[model samples]
Target: MDGLRLENEIEGEKTILMLKERRPIRHIVNIPKTRNTFCKGTKCRKHTPHKVTQYKAGKASLFAQGKRRYDRKQSGYGGQTKPVFHKKAKTTKKIVLRLECTVCKYKMQLPLKRCKHFELGGDKKTKGAALVF
Candidate 1:
């Protein structure tokens, strides 16, 4: 049967299994440029306005201990010393928001759920408005 399975048992019992249908959900998220939240900075410990931005990882340093050790092990005419990784499973990355306190200029990071579409400081949505092309 379509999307259905039937199993027969030896004890004269029959079972019916129904497979769940999967649906893809597409949602677009929009965030504002500024936020009002509590700041944990030493100077500003109360609620304050924060500037919001997307957090990006900095460049990796070649002089790090791990990099140095790897480079030293790789130089001596030996093939790949370590196994390369190829088993990546996740398709989307978690979004991180960087919030900076306006008064103290202190920065903090907040992680968000994974989403297919992400928008920062995009246009605001109005109620009862038609979709524009």
Candidate 2:
């Protein structure tokens, strides 16, 4: 607290609304990820050779410490048990488009339309659905 400045302050009430963990990892190049370079065993603290594992679509990550940095729960001493974000967020791709309809040969367009045969954005009933989006 002497030299460090806390940019964002967390209130106890806000924890209920924002239980999910979120990280401000915008780009990869910004991260200080150690590659396959191993510190010399005699001099290095952890003389393990860490391979340059590219971050997949949030898959089974190898970096255990890196993952925990994204989650922080402060409650009564240890704080209340926080909800896991894995249940909420799905496997979303920034570039790739996922179709709700696997059978339909139609493509999900920019301006998603309500097609009787295809579901551009996954709607229960296609009736009266004229591109609600």
Candidate 3:
């Protein structure tokens, strides 16, 4: 009942009641620096320790087919070739973790839930600890 809201309405001797609960959205998410998971590498197909890091996309290649086509289409005297995307619906991007197997050096990607803020190798949270100002 801490974050609950109740409403009652009466119409023609009929009573209607409604209850709603509100929860705050979490902002920050902390992840560990390393993880022990199953490695799918040919050399190491067993559970092993892996170094964890946030996955980042590399720079786009200019020689790619899409980039080459786009560049060629824009080379002419055209104001705008394609419609620019403006209707972005998502507020947060899914976080991807890059895990590398320690023994075989095999890398794999693991996607996580979307969060407003992501922290890598952050401090652990202790229960019942007083909040520091």
Query: Which lDDT tens digits does candidate 3 get at residues 1-133?
Result: 4444555556646554455655444589999999999999999999999999999889999999999999999897967898999999978888999999999999999998888999999999999999998
Cα lDDT for residue 112, candidate 2: 23
lDDT of each: 0.89, 0.35, 0.89
Return whichever of 2 and 3 wins on lDDT.
3
lDDT tens digits by residue: candidate 2, 9-64: 47743322223444343222221223223333344434343322222254667457
Relative to the unseen true structure, what is the C-alpha lDDT of residue 5 in candidate 2, on a scale of 0 to 100? 32
What's model 3's overall lDDT?
0.89
Least well predicted 10-residue stretch by lDDT in candidate 3: 16-25
How big is the positional error of residue 79 in model 3, measured in Å on the Cα after superposition? 0.7
Pick the winner on TM-score between candidates 2 and 3. 3
Ranking by TM-score: 3, 1, 2
Per-model root-mean-square deviation over C-alphas: 5.6, 21.4, 4.9
Candidate 1: C-alpha lDDT: 0.89
Go through the candidates in order and give the clash count of each.
0, 1, 0
